[model samples]
Target: MKNTICPKCGNETQELYDGRCKDCFFENFKLAELPLVLHAKICATCGARFNKNKWANTGSIEDIVFNTIEDALFIHDRAEDIEIYFEPRQLSPHMYRVKVEINASVMGMPLHQKLKTEVRITREACDACSRISGGYFEAIIQIRATNRQPSPEEIQKCMRITNEVLERMHKKGDRFAFISNSAEDKDGLDIYVGSTNASRHICKEIESYLGGSFSESPTLFGRKEGKDVYRNTFSMRLPEFSAGDIIELRDRVIEVRKFGKNVTGTDLLNGSRFLAPPDEVKGATLIAKRSTAANAVLVAIENNELMVLDPDTFETVTIKKPVLLSAKAGDEIAVVKTSHGLIALPEEVSRKNNL
Candidate 1:
């Protein structure tokens, strides 16, 4: 090893960095640099931060302040084994004083630098929040039922599904996944959504949970930035019958257990499992619900027949017994009265009564 003389300071040293001794090189070298003041844009309603020319849901106000400071911090390229720490003091709700400490080594020499900056938070509406507040919507979902009005329970379930899907989409970086408005009409429920893609997802989830199908149609709403803008309307039709509904089709009486693309139920006439497509049961009249059945007195039982006293009229009537019937003589049994005659319900219906 040979000793070298620094040209700038005239000092003797074993090594020279950038034509200067270690002491002279370090005298003017800047280990770290940061602006005295920084600004952070945040949404007043959703608490989202604006950074890198975009808005994001980046945690709390303190985290946003720290991130803003870190993005603006500049460290020397020659520094190695660097470590940084931040100490923040909240001066007010919209202002913060942060002190940054940097520790590193340059040319095998330990170096430390402390910098201070003030972060001013400007609260305003982001793009998504602005659009939401302006009642902007890209799609509308109409929840309806086939051959009947949507029940309150069904409507509520649909709304729940919509919210869940929108929330998931938002977390996945879809800022426009939000509900703008919702209205209840005599026909059904109408939900206005911000994103058409999110609306499609909501409809699909609703159909999976409930039994139904949906169709989408786009209407030219206006022009934006020299481009045509179209808004979509999703029409969802729920299944005609829900669970526990007793329907009569042609010559068969069926108790619906589930209804989707395919209808599943137990035939009340013979207690056999019934499965058919929606079109097969078209015009099936909803005769009654298992919940509305009345208790009748069981008098006797013959081969494949049950003798029961009618609930309305105390006349002993003999009806064809269902295979699932488990009632004994002198006991009460569930029976539904129709235009045909008094009919004994299956054991599943009786168990529902206890529940």
Candidate 2:
């Protein structure tokens, strides 16, 4: 027996089970079950999520998983991992987005700078030829060749190198997106995506020339503001048709008490005090409806809408009228008019969901 900590639940494992014990191991394994369509940058040491900051020097992968602190890394381990990383990372549980950089080429060619892969070519760039020639030009070329936090001079050189490639390609009848690390000059060392039709041709040519680079991420370079990357915040929307989910079914309001007319909506808990559009709520499957005597089951909803239990049984009313409950089980449900439809939601997921 050995002791290991479940990184997420922070529970102690009594045996070595997939780096965790029996009860705690399931969470990690479950992550593998879920489609991995999301990629995120995290701290190599503390496992804290990374954004709003630049990172480099991630450690190499072992098979597909990277489990080393000395290495800054990301691991995509599944079928969906090929297209886009898939994992529900709650920027806020209800709202999520995935970010990743492309790896390898369409031909499946490997590019390793460390190994000096001949497939990875580095040509002396000449952007000056492009800028001076107006339309027909060769881009500039510069390099830091030294490692001291990639100086402004180094980045400048990288940008010039990028331009040179663009220039050479343009002359050769190519129009691709300009991707870069970052910039010294906000105006110059930036990214640019070409026209749709021409872009396809140019991108192909560039891919054929330079496969991949550790210093560059085309995805970041092609970052489309306000749309692809946004301060977007949204909640789940329940289905309105075919009824897989509905609102006001298991709607139980906790911590409600008599309050003055001036009491703000915040007085209600267990759910939103102020109602949002029906589309903004989570859905749950409608289970068997029954009736029972339960006091304090009524609550106010929307504008002047009262959710009250039937006086006789106080349970979810079965439309077309049928009774289903065992008296020995003390099973009693609240009966009320269903305004929203029902959606089948997983038990575990629904529990974790707040929306």
lDDT of 2 by residue, 4-102 (tens): 677656777665454555555433432212223323444333223332353322233221122211122333242132322222223442224332233
lDDT by residue for model 1 (1-355), tens: 8887789878789987888887888888999999999999999999999999999988889999999998999999999999999999999988999999999998788999999999999999999999999999999999999999998888989988998899999999899999999999889999999999999999998887778899999999999999999999999999889888889999888888878768888987777889999889889999888777789999999999999999888998999888887889999998887667888888884324111
TM per model?
0.87, 0.15
The most accurate candidate by TM-score is: 1
lDDT of 1: 0.90
Assess candidate 2 and give its lDDT. Answer: 0.29
Model 2 root mean square deviation, Cα atoms: 30.2
* Every model: Cα RMSD to truth: 3.4, 30.2
Clashing pairs in 1: none
Worst 10 residues of 1 by lDDT: 346-355
Q: Once superposed on the true structure, which residue ranges of model 2 sit more than 4 Å away at CA?
A: 1-148, 176-190, 193-355
